[model samples]
Target chain A: MAGSLLIELDRVEKTYVQAGVDTRVLRGVSLAVGRGEFVALQGPSGSGKSTLLHILGLLERPTAGRYLLSGEDVSGFADDRLSELRNRHFGFVFQSFYLIPYASALENVLLPGLYGPESRRSLEHRAQELLARVGLADRASFKPSQLSGGQQQRVAIARALINQPAVIFADEPTGQLDSATSAEIMQLLADICTQGASIVMVTHDEETAAFAQRRIRILDGRILDNGGPGPAEG
Target chain B: MRRALRLLPRVAGFALDAVLAYRLRSAFVILAVALGIAALTVIVTSIDGANRKALEIVDMFGHDAVFLLGGDIESRAVGKRTLTLTWDDARTIRQSIPGAYLAVPMRAKSNITARFGSRNFDLPVVVGTTEGYAQVWNWPLSEGRDFTAEDVAHGAKVGLIGDTVAQELFGDRSPVGQIVFLGSLPVQIVGRLSYRGLSGGGGSVDDRIAIPLTTLAQRFNLDRKYFRAIRVKFHNPEFMDAHVENLRSLLRHLHRIAPDQPDDFTILTADQILQFLAMLRGGLVAFLGLTAGGAILVGGFVLANLFSISVAERTTEIGLRKALGAATWAITAQILAEAAMLTLAGALLGMALGMGLGQALSRLGILEIQFSMKVFAIAVASALAIAAIFGLRPARHAAGLDPVQALRRSEG
Candidate 1:
C-alpha cells in the first residue's frame, strides 16, 4: 500500500435507539486508509463492521465525532453534499448485489455517471470497459435477473468503478456467492487495488479477509487495538 | 441541476420500468384515472354538441324573427282554447310598428289526413297561412312556386307541401301538378318546401303543409276573423329586446288587459329559446361536472395512495439511487414526472373510449355528440393536474427518506 493518507476518522460513534432502548453500534472507533491500499474489516455478527463501512462511505453520519476525507473534516456535512462526495469520492458494493433488477447490467453500471456533476456521454465507453475488466462485457445487455449471483456481483463492481471513485466500500461482496465464484470476486478485488484504487472491505470470513494486504478486527462495536484502525497495517 | 438534468432519462426510465413491473397495481390506478376522464370527455362533448345544435337552430330560426302565439308556450299553464287575437291584430301590428317588421298570421291544425289519388298519408300538421309565410319562415322551395297574393285574396285551393309530404304523396315523382285533398277539400300542390331536419321550436318543419289562408278559412269555416299565431320579423335584430317590450305593451293595450295580469298571448323568439337552451345545458354540465369532479377526487386519492405504496415498496431502489448521487429534488421530479405520464396515458385512452360511447349515444338520437377542441384540452389538462397535484405529497415522502434507514429496511 502507498503512504499518503486519504481517509481519517477520529473517535466516531453510532447509536441506535429502539422503543426507548439505546444500542451503541460503533463506539469511539477511529480508522484511516491510505491511497491505493487494500484493507478488510473483520468482525462477528453485530460487531458494527458494516456500520463502520457505512460511515466511512458517507452513506451515514456518525452520531458523534469527526471524519475527514483527504484531511478535510466532513463529519457534519449536509446530506446532499455528503451524497455528492459519495458519488465522486467513494463507491459501495452491498452483499445483496442491489443492481436494479429491471435495468440491464450496462445500464446499472452507467448509474453513477448518470447522476454525477457533468455529461455522461463519455461514461458509456468507460462503463463498457469496466464491465469488460470485470469479465462481464458480453453480458452487458442482460438484466440483473438474467445474471447469476457471481455475474451480478461483478456488475456491481463494474458499477462501483464507473466514476473512478477514490475508495471502494464493499460490504460482504462475495457473501452470496459459492466458494469458486467467491475466489474469483476476491481476485477481481485484488486486481482493482493494484489499479491504484483504495478498498475497505467488511467480511466475517478470514479467507475473504486474506485477499486484503492489511486487516483490522472489531468486536462488540469497539476496536481491539489503537482504540481504532489506522492507515498503517492493523 | 445539470447533474439532475443528465439523470432525467434514467429517472424516467426507472419510473416507467416500475409501472410495467407492477402491472396489476399500475393498471388499477390507470383504470381509476381513465374512468374519470372518460366520463368528463363524454359529458363535456355532449354538452358542447348540444350547444352547437342549439346554435344551428338559431341559424335556422333566423336571429331577427319572433313568434307571437295565441297559446301558452312561455310557461306550463295552458288551455288549448281558441284565442281572441285576430287577423286584424296582425294587420295592426304590421302597419303600426315602424321597425320594418313583417307580421304573417298563421292558423294550424295537426294530424290531418291528405289523399292524392288512391294514396293517403297522415299529415303531421296543416298550416293556414298567407302569401308571405315562406319568406317569413325563411323556408325555400325545392320545386315549383310559392302561392302569390292573388291566390290568398281569391281563396284559391293551392297547397305548398314540404319535401317529406311530397315524398309520401307522389313517391319519386314531383308533386307540383298534383291535387291533394285535405278532408273533403281538394287542393293543387303549388310548390315543395326544402327539407329542414329539425326546427328550433320543436318538431320537423318539413313534415307539414302550407295553404292559402282564405282557402282554409272559407273551407274549414275556421273563423276568418282569428289567427292562431303571428310570425314577426324585424329588419334589425339588435333592437330585439326593446321591440319585445314594445310589442308586449301594444298587445296588452289592444287586449285591454290590466298591468298585473299575465299577458293573454305568449311571445317566442330565437334568442329566448337559445338562452333557455343554454341555461338548461349549463345546469346539466354543472351537475355532470360535479359528479365527474367527485370521480376525479376519488381517483386522484387512489392514485396518490398507490404511489405512496409504490414509494414504500421501492424504498431500497430509492436508497440505491440516492447512494449513487440522486438528490431529493431528483427523486421528487422522477415520481412527479411518472405521475404525469400515467395520468396522461389514462386521459388519452379515456378520450378514445369516450368517443365510442358518445357516438353510441348519438346513434340512439339522444343528442348529436361532437368533440370540441377546446373541451378536449380542458379534459386532458384537468386529469393530468389532479394526478400531479395529488402525487406531490407521496413524492415528498419518498424524497425525505433517510438513505441508510431505507437501505436497512430493504435489506431486512
Candidate 2:
C-alpha cells in the first residue's frame, strides 16, 4: 500500500453463476488510484470497465481477492459498515445522472449530505453553493424532469461533491451528452481534480479519457495496463 | 433517540412528498381508511348511545312505575281480543297491593279514524283511561288542564290530546276546548300532552288521544268492566318486589286462578325494560364490533396491497437512497411513517363525519348518540394497527432491495 494511494485493488476477481453458467466479469484485475488524481478507465462495451469502477466504488464486492480503501482491508466489511465507508470516503456519478425524478435540483444536490456529517442548515447552504457552482442556481427548484440532459449531469456532479469524499467513481458521466456538453463536464471534472479529489471514470471515448491525468485499459475482464496511453484502437 | 427525533420531521416530510407524488393512489388509500374509521366511530357512538338510552328510559319511566299487559289474548282464541284481567282485578290490586299509589286502568285501540269539521286524520292510537292517566304514564300536560275526577265520574265527553295529534287536528291553534269526532262520538279536547316522541316499539308516542274510561265504555259501545291494561305507581320503589308479588297474588285471587296456573297478564317495570335494553345493547355492540373489525381488515388489506405494489414499483428510488447511505431501517421507517400519516388523516376525517352524522341523528331524535375518549382511542389505535400490520410487509420488501441490482434493473 502506498501512502499516496486513495484506492488500491489487489488481484480482484468477480464471477457470476447465472442459470448455472459461469460468467466471470472481472478476471484478477489489480489497480491503484492515487490521491488527487483523475484516473480514466477505458474499454469497449463488455470490456468490464463498469465492473471495475463498481468494485472501486464499493458498490460490489469481488468474489476473490482483497480491496483496500485508504490502506484499510475493507473487502470483508459488512454491508452497513461498507455503506458508511462509501458515504465517508467515496462518491458516484452515473451516465444517466440518476437524479431523483421527484426532487428539485437543490434537493438532489443536498441528498448526500443527508447521509453524511453536514447539518441541515449547512447542507442547504452547501447545496445552494454547489447548484451555483454548476451554474444552475436559478434552476435549483427545477426537477430532474424539467432539466436538460446536460443540466441533470451537472446536478449529479454537484451531488457527488456534496459529501467532500476522497474519490468519485463516475461510470460514463458524459455518455449521454453532446460533445460540447461533454467537454464542459470534462472541464468541471478537471477542476474538481485540481481541488484535491481523486476520480476513477469509466469511458470508451478517447477524448473523454484525455481529461484524466492517467489512463487504464481493460479488455476481456482483465486490465491490460495500469498506465496505458489509451485503450487499443478497434 | 435524539437522532430519531431529528429525523422524524424529515422522514415525515419525505413521506408526504412521496404521497403527494402518487396522488391518485394515496387518495384511494385515504378513502379506504376513512371508511374503516367511519364505521368504527359510528359503532362506538351507537353503542354508547344505546347504553345511555337504557339509563334514560329508567329515568323517564321511574322505578316505581309498572304496567300490567294483557296476555294470551290471541292464544285463547278470544273473539274481540278482550282483556282477561278485568276491572275487578284492577280494583283488587289498588285496594290490596301495598305501597300502591295509583292504579289507572286503560283500554287502547289502534288505527282509529277521527274528524274535526273538514279536516280528517287516521290516528294511530285511541286510549280510554281514568283521571290519573297522565300522572300514571308520566305524560304531563304542556297546555290546558287535565281531565278531572268529576269528568270521569260523569263519563264526560272530554279528550286529552297528545301534541302530534293536536297539531294534526288543530294546526298551530291550541286544541283545548275544540271538539273533534272519534268515529260518531264528539269529544272536546281538554289538555295537550307533551311530545314524548317514539316508544320502544317504534310507534309515535305523541300521536294518541285519551278519553275517560266511562266515556269510552258508554260512547264507543265498549264493555266498562274490562280494560286492556292497568298501570300502577308505588309510594316507595325500594319495596317494588314486594308490591309486585302482592299485586300478582291479589290479581290471581281476584281472577280465581289456581296456584300452579300461569297468570293471564304480564307485568312490566322500568327495571325489566332496562334489563331488556341492556341485553339488546350487548348484542348490538357485538354485531357492530364484528362489522367494524371486518371493515378495518378489508381496508388494511387494500392499504397493504397498495404499499406492496408501491415498494415493488419504487425499487430504483429505494436503491438510490440506499446508495446515498440510507440504511434498511431508515427506508422502513419512512415507509411506515407514510402509512401512519395516511391513516391518521383518514381517521380524523372519519371522526368529523361520524360526529356530524351522529349529532344530526340525535337532534332529529331518530337515535341517541354519545361519545367518549375511549371511542377516539379505539379508532386511532385501530387505524395505527392497521397501518403497521399492513405497512410492514411492503417496507421489508423495500428494505431488502439491493442497490446495484435495483439501479441496473431500472437502467435496463
Candidate 3:
C-alpha cells in the first residue's frame, strides 16, 4: 500500500449453520485497501465475493479472522461499538439504491447524519451540498419512486458520504443502470475516491471493475490475486 | 444517549411517514383503539356523574335526617305506593325517641297535573305534608310564608309551590296568594319554595306542589290512618345511629310486629344512600369495565398483528437504515414511536366521540355522563400503555433483523 491503510483483512473466514449442517461461505482471505484507494472485487456468482464485501462493510462478522480498519483490529468489537464505528467511519452503496421510498432525495441523503453527532442545520446543509455534488440538487425534493434508477443511485451515493466515512463499500452500485449511467456512476465513485475517501466495490462486470485503480479476484471464498496498483483503464 | 436524542425528530418524522404510507393498516388499529378509549371515557364520565348526584342528594337530604318510607326497601316495586306508615307513626316517633326532635309525615304522587287559569303543567310532584315539614326538611319558603299550625289543624286547603311550578303556571308573577288546582281541588298558594336543581334520579326537584296533609287526605279520599313516608330530624347528628335504633324499635313496638317479622317500613339515612349508590356504581363499573377491556384487548391485538406485518413489509427499509448506521435501539424507537402516535390519535378521536355520545344521552334524558380533564388523561394514559405492551414484540423483531440477510432477502 502506498498510502495509510484504511481496511485490512487477515485470513478472514465465515461459516453459516442451518438445520444441523455447517456451510462454509468464506475461506482464508487476505486483502488491504489504503486511504483514497479505489479497489474492485471481481468474481462469479457464489464465489463468496458478496460475503467478503459484507464482512468488510461490518454488516456481518467473520466467523474466524482478524479484520482491521485503519490498522486497528475490530473483530472483537461489540455490536453497538461496531454500529458506532459503522456510522462514524464506514458508508455503503447497494445495487438497488435502497433509498427510503417515503423520504425525498434530500431526506435520504440526510439519513446517516441523523445517527451521527452532527447538528440538524449543518447536516441539512451538507445534504443539500452533496445532492448538488451528485447533480441531483434540483431533484432533492423528489421521492425514490418519482426519480429514475440512476438518480436514485446518486441519492444513495450522496447518503453514503453524509457521515464522511473512511471507506465506501459499494456492491454492484451500477447493476440496475444502463451502460452509460453505469459509467457515469463509476466515474462519480472514482471522483469521490480521489477526494480522499477509500472505495471497495464488488462487481462481476469487467468493464465496471476496469474503472478502479486495482482489481482483486475472488473464487471459492479465497482471493486469487490482489492486482498491482495502476491507472484505471478507460 | 445524546445521539439518540438528536435523532429523535428525524426518527419521529420517519415513523410518521410510515404510518401515513400504510393508511388502511393504520386506520384499522386506530379505529380499534378509538372504540376502546371511547368506552373507557363513557364509563369514567358516568361514574363521575353518579358520584356528583350522590353528593347532591346528601346535601339536600341533610346529614342529621332519616327517611322512613312506607314500603319495604328490598321488595318495593315501582309505581305501587305502600301505605304502611301513617301520621300517627310520625307523632309517635317524635314523642318516643329521646334525640329525635322533629318528624314530618308526607304523601306524594308524581305526574300530577297542577293548573293555574288555563295553563297546566304535568309531571309536577304533589306532596301532602304538615306545617313543620319545611323546618324539618331544612327548606324555607323563598317568596311567601309557610303554612301555620292552624292550616294543619283546620285541614285548610293551602299549598306551597316550588320554583318550577311558579315559573310554569305563573310565569314571572309571584305565585303567593294565587289559587291553583291540584287535580280537581283548588288551593291558594301560601308560599313559593326555593329552587332545587336536579334530583338523584335526574328529575327536576323544583317541579313540586306541597299541600296540607289533612286537606290532601280529605279531598283525595285517601286513608287518613296511613301515609307514605316520614322525615325524621335528630337533635344531634353525632348520635344518629343510636337515634335510628331507638326509632326503629319504637316503630316496631307501635306496629305490634314480632321479633321474627321483617319491618314493613324502611329507614334510609345519608350513609345508606351512599352505600346504595356505591352498589349501583360497582355493577356499572364491572359491566362497563368488561366492555372497555374487550375493546382494548381486540385493539391491542390488531395493533400488534398490524405492526408485525408492517415490520415484515419494511424489512428492506430496516436493513437500509441499519446499513445507514441506525442502531438496534434506533430502529426499535422508530417503530415504537409509530405505535405511540397512532394510539394518541385514536385516544383523541375516542374522547371526542365519547363526549358527543355522552352529551346526546344527557340531553335526551337517557343517561347523565360527566366529562372532565381527568377522564381525558386516563383515556390517553391507557391508550399509551396499550401501545407499549403490544408494540414491543414487532419493534424487537425489526431491531433484531440482520442487515445483510434483510437486504439479501429483499434482493431475492
Fraction of true A-B contacts recovered by candidate 3:
0.70
Question: Which pairs clash in the backbone of model 3?
Answer: none
Residue-wise C-alpha lDDT for candidate 3, range B98-155, written one tens digit per residue: 9888888898767779888999988556888887777877787788888787998889
Task: Highest DockQ: give the candidate number.
Answer: 3
* Model 1: CAPRI class: medium
Candidate 3: lDDT of B188? 95
Q: What local lDDT does model 1 show for residue B6?
A: 65
Per residue, candidate 3 scores C-alpha lDDT tens digits across A181-208 of 9999999999999999999999999999
Q: Which rank order by lDDT, best down to worst?
A: 3, 1, 2
> Fraction of native Cα contacts kept in each candidate?
0.63, 0.35, 0.70
Better model by DockQ: candidate 1 vs candidate 3: 3
Best candidate, TM-score-wise? 3
Q: What's the CA RMSD for each of the models?
A: 3.1, 4.2, 2.9
What TM value does the first chain of each candidate achieve?
Answer: 0.94, 0.95, 0.95
Candidate 2: misplaced stretches above 4 Å?
A1-5, A8-32, A44-48, A61-78, A115-117, A219-224, A228-234, B72-82, B113-122, B144-147, B167-178, B197-202, B235-253, B256-260, B278-295, B348-379
TM-score of 2: 0.86
Residues A69-137 of candidate 2 have per-residue lDDT tens digits of: 878899999887777788777888988789988889998888777765558998899889988998999
User: Could you give candidate 2's per-residue lDDT for residues B43-137 as a string of tens digits?
Assistant: 89988888776776777778888888777432454463447767777777777787897888898877778898888878877898887888887
